[model samples]
Target chain A: MGEILVKEKEIVAPGDVLASGMDYIPTDGAFRDGENIVSSLLGLVYIKGRLIKVLPLNGVYIPKKDDVVIGRVSDMTYSSWFVDVGYAYDAVLSLKDASSDYIERGADLTTYFNIDDFIIAKVLKVNKSMAIDLTMKGPGLRKITRGTVITITPQKVPRVVGKMGSMVSLIKENTGCQIVAGQNGRIWINGTVPDMERLAVKAIKFIEQNAHKSGLTEMVKTMLSKEAKK
Target chain B: MSYNKRFDGRKFTETRPMKAKTGVVKNAVGSAMFQIGKTRAIAAVYGPRELHPKHLQDPSSGRLRCHYNMMAFSGSGDRVRPGPSRRSKEISYVTELALSPVLDLSAFPKTVVDVFIELVQTDAGTRCAGICAASMALADAGLKMKDLVCAVSVGLVGGTPVVDLNYEEEAYEEGAVDIPIAMTPRDGKFSLLQLDGDLSKEDFEKALALAKDACQKIYEVQKNALKERYVEDKK
Candidate 1:
């Protein structure tokens, strides 16, 4: 038998013991020491059955394979385009993986994706050396045009998307904005009226600042409605 | 312990006034400004993002780098030069070592976390104050750390060990020994220890004990600084 020390959604400091039992297993943001599972970060604790993990309140984004992300074109080489995906190493987007059309060797690569252009792409692969491979050929993957992009802490992206995307859908439906919430903490919002776009940004910021609070979805819904009428 | 009165007109174990706040720099991930008596230092933390110059990237875990500098007008008399000095380089290295133990580096692999500390005002014990500020900046950046690092300097003046020496006391003749120690307050384990001048074995032990006690008081202040920041933001 093991004892669980923290309540659900409670803020826990690093090195705080989350649980003690041989039957319990540690997950993300937690590590095992002897018979205890200790939190390794400042975060909110979530326990599911015997598996316990901590949700960090703040951190930079770490890209994973198959994640949809928004990146800016940083540099161009003979055969590849380096994308700044908010990570240490620029993700490589080779011409071959970029699109279905074959690009001629030595052809000006800027015509396809120029420097400082934002693109919504997918992570094709991440290697042992942390070399990331990206692709723009997938569905919903293309260059972003004429929309405002806002960056938030990547740890809050899940909250912005809400459970099953109910939160995002509410924002889109009320404001009539085409919003794409990237897992990398970059959001793309295009609205017919500039006020709507600004409203969406404000709502997203609210989510980022108050992600830990309960009843956030209801609060966001009320806020959006009040702003939409104005 | 026979010194009834000291240069600062305080008891031997007394410390200077401390004030600290986090999130001062808007651009950096986390930032803090700390002042102990007349000694003030500001620290900023960035990254867990990409580590540039790919060759320096560590494969197993994120690298922690610190830069400690003193501003030109921070000293008492002549203005210091604005550049990296040997003393600054050594302090930066020790500061990095002091903070590395508490961070969960493996969580952000193939990245780097940079902490920059600048001494805005110098009385004495600036490096120790810088260590304290850097720890708060790291926490304000929301990086996962096991425990906050708290530090204070203990020095021997007139054959008596004193806590938190001032500028004049630190420059005493008679071979005064200044020992600065940094540790994780929760566990009472020392992460950084440096000795300047000379002390006997028995005296060094006594100084260490005094420093450990002073660290506990400093830890309370550090904890309160962090809580105050978050509490205000909640409202």
Candidate 2:
């Protein structure tokens, strides 16, 4: 029989022994070393049946296919626009995928998406060399304007989104703000009143900062309600 | 002449007091400051981002570059020159070698992870201190690492095996052999070993053992520093 050394949700550093024996399998941020399973990251421990995995607490934004992300236009070629999605490489937004409408060759691309413009784009493809291709034709994908942008740790994006987006909806309902959260950890918030936008941003940041804790939903709710009155 | 008591009145196998903290540099992706006795090293990790100088990009996996430097007034004796020297270049190369084994950069092709280590104070074992600080910073940056790296200077001070020889011990009249060592604690394997003086085979083996034991202690400090950073955020 295998022995599980760490409890569920326990924080572990790299090389920490997670389990000891062949009956235990390692996956994701955990790895097998001889007869013992070891953690390969500084993260929370998770176990499912005999399989062990670690969810990282911190990391840079790695681009993935089909992930919605917000990017800034850094440069433009004659046929495509280079969008920086907070990754090591800039994603390309080709003219054809730039929009549903037809664009002429050598068209003044600046008129459509100028440099420094922020746009919500979807990852179309990521090659072996990590070159990313982005599309702007998807639903809810458009150039963002008249909103303040904030960034948080990319690893905390799932927490900010919450279960079926309940957390985001809570913030929206309480603050009356239009918000878009990107998988790359950028959030766009716009509201009629500056104070409401600030509240939403505060809530998102709160979630990001306290993503590792349990009962976060209740904590966030209490915080939002208390702040809403003042 | 015989070496009886330590110059600092420490035990033969004792290292100086250590202090470590992560996320010290707010602008960096990850950063840490490590101090041992009078020696202090601060390390910052910048990327798994694109590698510039077009030709240096590796298509197969990412590369790691380390920069080790000492401040102008950090040295105990004289002012260090501002720019990179031959000695700094060598230490930088060794620091990279000391850290690369545990780091898994295969997922980031054509990119580079840069580690900059600055020695703010120096008594002895500056390179070893830098390696320890750099390792913690890399982990704080969320880089995939197999284990934390620990380092210390261990050697024969007048034929007595000691762990973490200070500057005065290195300059002992009876002569001292300063051997700086770095280890991957989980595996108990040496990643860095450099000797500055001569020692008998038996003495060298004893010193190596002392270094191994000292490294384990340093590992605990490094691990706690990383965990404590998150613990403090909860309050």
Query: C-alpha displacement of B141 in model 2, angstroms?
Result: 0.9
Which candidate tops DockQ?
A: 2
Which ranges of candidate 2 are over 4 A from the true structure? B233-235
Predicted candidate 2 versus true structure: per-residue lDDT over A59-97, tens digit per residue: 789899999999999999888999999999899999889
- In TM-score terms, candidate 1 sits at 0.90
Q: What C-alpha lDDT do the candidate models reach, one value each?
A: 0.86, 0.92
lDDT string for model 1 (A1-230, tens) is: 99998898777656567898888899988888788888766677999998999887766677899999999999998888999988767899988888787777778878889999999999999876677899997889999878899999888998899999999998898888999988889999999999889999999999988887788999999888887777
Q: B48-106, model 1: which lDDT tens digit per residue? A: 87787889978888899999999999999899999999999999999999999998777
lDDT of 2 by residue, B110-220 (tens): 999999999999999999999999999998888888998999999888888999999999998889999999999988999999999998899989999999999999999
Off by over 4 Å in 1: A17-24, A34-36, A102-111, B6-11, B49-55, B107-110, B172-175
| TM-scores for the candidates | 0.90, 0.97
Candidate 2 collision pairs: none
The per-residue C-alpha lDDT of model 2 at residue B137 equals 93
Give the per-residue Cα lDDT of candidate 2 at B216: 93
